[model samples]
Target chain A: MPTIIEKIFQMHTEDKVEAGNTIWLNIDLRTARDFAGAKVVKNLLKHYSSEYIEDATKTFFTFDCNAPANTIEYANNQQICREFARKNGIKVYDVGRGIGSHVVIEEGLAYPGITAVGTDSHFNILGSVGAFGQGMGDIDIAFVFKTGKTWFEVPETVKVNFIGTPSAPWSAKDLALLCVKELRRKVLGRAIEFYGEIVDELSLAGRITLASMVTEMGGIIGFIPPNREVINFYSKRSGKEIKPVYADDATYEKEIDIDVSNLEPLIALPPSPSNVKRVRDVHDIKVDSVFIGSCTNGRVEDMQAVAKILKGKKIAENITLKVVPATREVWREMMNGEIMKELFNAGAIISHSACAGCASGQIGMTGEGEVQVSTSNRNFKGKQGAGDTYLASPETAAASALTGYITGVDEI
Target chain B: MKVKGRVWKIEKDGKLMDDIDTDMIYHNKYLHITEQEEMAKYAFSNLEGWQDFPEKARKGDIIFAGENFGCGSSRQHAVDCFIALGINAIVAKSFGAIYKRNAINSGLAVLECNALDMAEVETGDEIEIDFETGEIKKNGICILKAKPMNKIQYAIYLAGNLFRYAEGI
Candidate 1:
């Protein structure tokens, strides 16, 4: 009668734990990004007074946010992480490696049944592959670095069933947006286990797109139990048999059914990710730029979606289309395929694999009075820039880039 | 333990504001500042109508916000900025999961009072909170009640922070 998360917790704690119980569980993988890596190191040394870490092999420093050091402050912070990792014999995924969460997944550092923690708020994206991933502050991450253990209040699980297949132009991002709109604030502080036919048929990239926005919905993590494809991918990558955890007679706090047959491509309006609207409902809104990247929808599948829409077509004259792959691996994959050529020919500014629009000083930063369409999560005021941001799928972003306005794929 | 302080209600349109995200509390542009004092200067700088919170706030003042306060990002600076401002406690309908943990780990007082918004209270109202009994008293009259800190929260609070609690253990 244990859910997937409960089983994962039991594996880490070696005890039966229930929801609402706060218990300490051993951490399998710990990471800090450039944004807070320096503070984590400083706090760890200040408290422990030694260069000793609990497990150097399990610890890593990832440089993705503000990759390549846009400013002197970011440069100094990345240097601090490099120095600490050098002294501790820890691995560092240097700049241009892309988002830390995606890097970990591609490297097989995070997989099904494992528990990983990072400084990124979207680290819960690991749930796409059935891993228990959490984001913490620098202080909490520092403690985990020293102890390799952290206490967590087991969140009650909510089962969300995605029924029916979404037609063309309506992709995982649209489904995710619909979920956010329908289940706003209801999943707060709880875990969501996505089930049903749509979830089972969804690809790894699709699962990631859905799980990445769980944070925007105020949920702890959104888990899509590792399907056969995910299990096979990990087994092949790790050169070992991978066992996927499944909920057996597990009871959930609540269950919600979302039918996508009648759903259209959706977009999150400015100021909040949950403030969603159908793409057609708000069409023709002039857009200054469109960004296709970030941990949310920067995978190869997302690139393919964009390429499919913009193949042999040039974007609008006044529109700035920025294309950033999620990871170096994704970038390499795009380079070997027609994705890059199509995007380049489409007049898109292909940037290095880094968090572009999501973080400041990147290629996707919006100017005042500008309206941008982004594939990344979160569009709160001043998040991308002083301008307004509309969160959409790669398909919508590509379509909008071509028209210089917010346009659904079907409209074009 | 009892905490008495003036209230700073985070409100909009005559109602408590909900979803006061971390970016609103501490904008991402100033994420590089690691010092608590430096973080204090930018508290609520991105939030509309509260851009001058850092300058107008007084020490030992308590904040009242609506549901899901501190909802975005896991940046501890959001909690640190308030602490740097010498805030007594933050009473909200609820808090973001990571934000709540960051608050407790940093030894900042965060209470959940569902009725705080409905109570007859306004900014500058004097209120006393009894940590032991989860009581909120305004002018010696019980107006609302909040969820007191749990065992782990109280222990960490008493010990100053997670690091101190770990040392004592």
Candidate 2:
């Protein structure tokens, strides 16, 4: 019996997909964003021509990163992408279209049992939908474009069982942080198959958030095996019947169990996502800005969570609160509902749904010596301009916005 | 493939740098810059004590790093920036998965060596590496032997890159 990943690979490769065996499989989907897709498209057209593109429709391009073109060079790069997409008939998501990863799922490009590759490392987010999302280099992506297939070294699979459900204020982000801490920064190049009650109970947004952070753990994929919840979720959106895959009882190489019953809201301190700490212990740390968006937590559920905390109340006067929805779909949903109104009325600067101001500071930059609590995946030094960033869930980020400090939702 | 060069030990405030993510090598602020040749100018621009690296680094120089080097972001520029700097190879205790893959695919030599004793080798120490056999010599002394790349990786490296390697296939 093989793990879910192995099983998927076997089906794609039509051979026994053993760990460390390199085999090529036809790619179901190829994704790229403006940040890296510019180079990928250039390389593809320059070295390999239209003939190299196996199927233009299978290739999806997006201009989410650095959207709105912060610089002239980026604008030029976006033009290059547009020209390439036009020539190849590839689907291109322009500025404010939303993140490529989210769009892939929303458009039903990714679904259960499919193998997809992307230029961004966080493509693993698609794994939450039971698709095999692997991040490949630009050359690899170009090759995949040129030839509708790519090779892979079957990775060892690790079983990650989330034993219990998370209570309020403790969303999937907190649960992911806990798993990251417990994994001890040694999960590099492994497929972490998340299962058990906690994963099955998490919403699609929560599952996507959980899978997005697997990059921080150095894992190739954070797979939540398909259950009825995710199957129905994808089927409802894609309007296609789907079959989910699960691992056998003894398929995984190693097992790690996480009990979320007592898990509290957590935050990854600046410079590294693995530097996690309990939210209550870091109350002394004040924040100058609060960002409630990113590929990780910029979803409808995350927006709803933040709005629930900020509704009927204003944020702290000293700090700025910025909300960027992950996609236009998410943004429209929030706007059509009360989330957008609650956020804006509560003093939040709700920016357009783009990758604005998360790491590049295209929209919201932290001032010198300032601190921030963000829901973004990365908190590396100066990631969001020249400030110390603390990574938290949307709930914590909203609660912190209320007090202008790194406070938990319960504290508010 | 083999490389001979001087080791540029990246340190700041008297502590060896660890987990130097791709952002530190090349920031997203410069992601818009498409030309790889021009990227070397901003190499280590965000990293402390290394902003002036482009001016100091020489062709065929090796970067010595601690665990999880080149972590974060699947930016090819992170690997390409070093190539622009004419970095011969990178010897670290470990490397981020994406960086390692990009490095190999781009024909940039990267080897995992456990004997990255910062105390044993000072900054600017001359080192020699045999990538095929995973041998490392510091100041003409064989200090460590890293695990050699598997057959597929070696073939890819020898062919100068993945594209060239795939051409023959």
Candidate 3:
């Protein structure tokens, strides 16, 4: 018998025809962000006369630019989206202070065992919470815009069994980078099922950090089933009492495990998400900029870690350090606490919560000659604004900002 | 897994600030800058060995770039460039995820090698690739170290997509 992932593939491969087989798994949840809306709306306006979209109910929209009052258009565009959703009766959520799309959704939206489709490539970051979430193009999404149904070819499942407690500053991001390095780029878009005792120890935020980067490894998604940690997470934010979603016990194409207990803070050099080495390996490499934000590592927990490291210290004079929160809610929490002040006092510019410098959205660009070390998932050269980009965990990126060289926080 | 293919030529790591090369992968007479045949003949435009490349260059083409090999939109034209031109594979030091995914889904191979050299490869040298195994050997030299594919990626390659399942895993 094939594993659950194999079952998904068999079903999609057979065109959803085989008995007990389904070719495409139905998506339980769908999400879209502002970056994709302009294109999506234009395409719809061009393709259809009156503006009809499929599957609007199963989808949700959230705005991330409320806090900084970033752009006049930011608030205006969100109002338009909210109005459209309200008029169409599509579910829209903000929790007032909702921030990043992935963070807000996993905070309360995703149901276990559900397949999620999003317009952005990084939406699969929620798989760490045990959901099969992935990305699609806006045009295909237009169909989902019209029907709320997404097509899948059922991917083969690669089982990643993680064991051993991860070393300090060496959290899920380390393992994720390792996967990207060892697995090569071809394995992308494959289902990744993360298991092992260590998975249980990671906070829900940590899992999001790990799952967010699964796309770095060329896998379709990365998932660890919901446990008490997740339950605790949901218990706080939601009263709807959504249930846990788990994959069928049987059927996986292959299983791979990692013992992160001994892992160190790893970093990916410029031009490749997979070209990674321990912080020690690149200690001597000089740095020009350091960034600690984005859906992958911009959560409150990550910000606290940064604050802990930068509280009394200032970043290197030549290096520019910046931070952005995962969501406005996270930003609010940080502002209420000492971390926000500490970061600003230490000379770190606070970018708004709207994916600043993460995707193409906004903020940070490379000059004629510049190198930036960041905690974002992709390090493909010039990924940030322009210039060279080096991928690192939050701790490493923070430390590099302090010394203007890649190093661990302890060294700073 | 990583597969080594000679780069037909590099496209762009960062968006080319000055010049806009159109006949990159697809043949569009609509652009009217050059004939589709001429573009293919001189394709990859000013890209080293790009124009000289046949309709399909084989594996072992080294794609060296400053940064961001596959940046812009996800148009499978680059993948189609390899497929239609019969280029065997591509080995860039880095690649865009969308480009890498599209290449794999389409059976065109691309590998990431920060140190790979197109200068070392003789054009049309018999390149070896085992996509299932992730092995790349060019002219008797084993260059890349490939890892195993995950379940879904393997199935996509084997079944040739969810639409056609000629073989079972």
Model 1 per-residue lDDT tens digits across residues A1-412: 7777888999999545999888888999999999989989888888787878999999999898898888899899999999999999999999998899999989988989999999989999999999999999998999999999988889999989877876654788988899889888799999999998888988999999999999988899989989899998898776767887889889999999988878788899999999999898995589998989999999999999999999999999999898999999999999999999999999999989888778784684789999999999999999999999999999999999998889988889
lDDT of 1: 0.91
Q: lDDT (CA) for every model shown?
A: 0.91, 0.83, 0.60
Candidate 1 per-residue lDDT, tens place, B21-113, comes to 999999988988888888998999999999999999999999999999999899999999999999999999999999999999999999998
Please give the distance, in angstroms, between residue B136's alpha carbon in candidate 2 and its true position after superposition. 1.4
Question: In model 2 chain B, which range of ten residues has the least summed lDDT?
Answer: B113-122
Model 3, range A1-412, lDDT digits (tens) per residue?
5443444333333354332232445556666555444334444565566675555656776554243334555445556566666766766654234444455454566645456666566777767666566665444454456545534445666777777776565766777787777665445446777778877778877888888777666666777778887766676665666466556665666667666777777888866677788878675777888888887888889899889888888888978887887777788889999999999988898876766665444455666468888888876543465567888777778888888877876686
lDDT of 1 at A120: 89
Can you list each candidate's DockQ?
0.84, 0.67, 0.07
TM-score of chain B of 3: 0.56
Candidate 3: stretches off by over 4 Å: A1-22, A63-100, A166-169, A247-249, B1-169
> Which digits, one per residue and each the tens of the lDDT, describe model 2 over residues A119-186?
88788888888889877778888888888787677889888877766565468899888887887455
Each model's TM-score?
A: 0.99, 0.96, 0.70
Candidate order (TM-score): 1, 2, 3
Instruction: Identify the candidate with maximal TM-score.
Output: 1
Ordered list by DockQ, greatest first: 1, 2, 3
What's the distance in Å from true for residue B56, model 2?
1.7
The residue-level lDDT of candidate 2 at A408 comes to: 88
- Ranking of candidates on lDDT, top first: 1, 2, 3
Candidate 3 docks with a DockQ of: 0.07
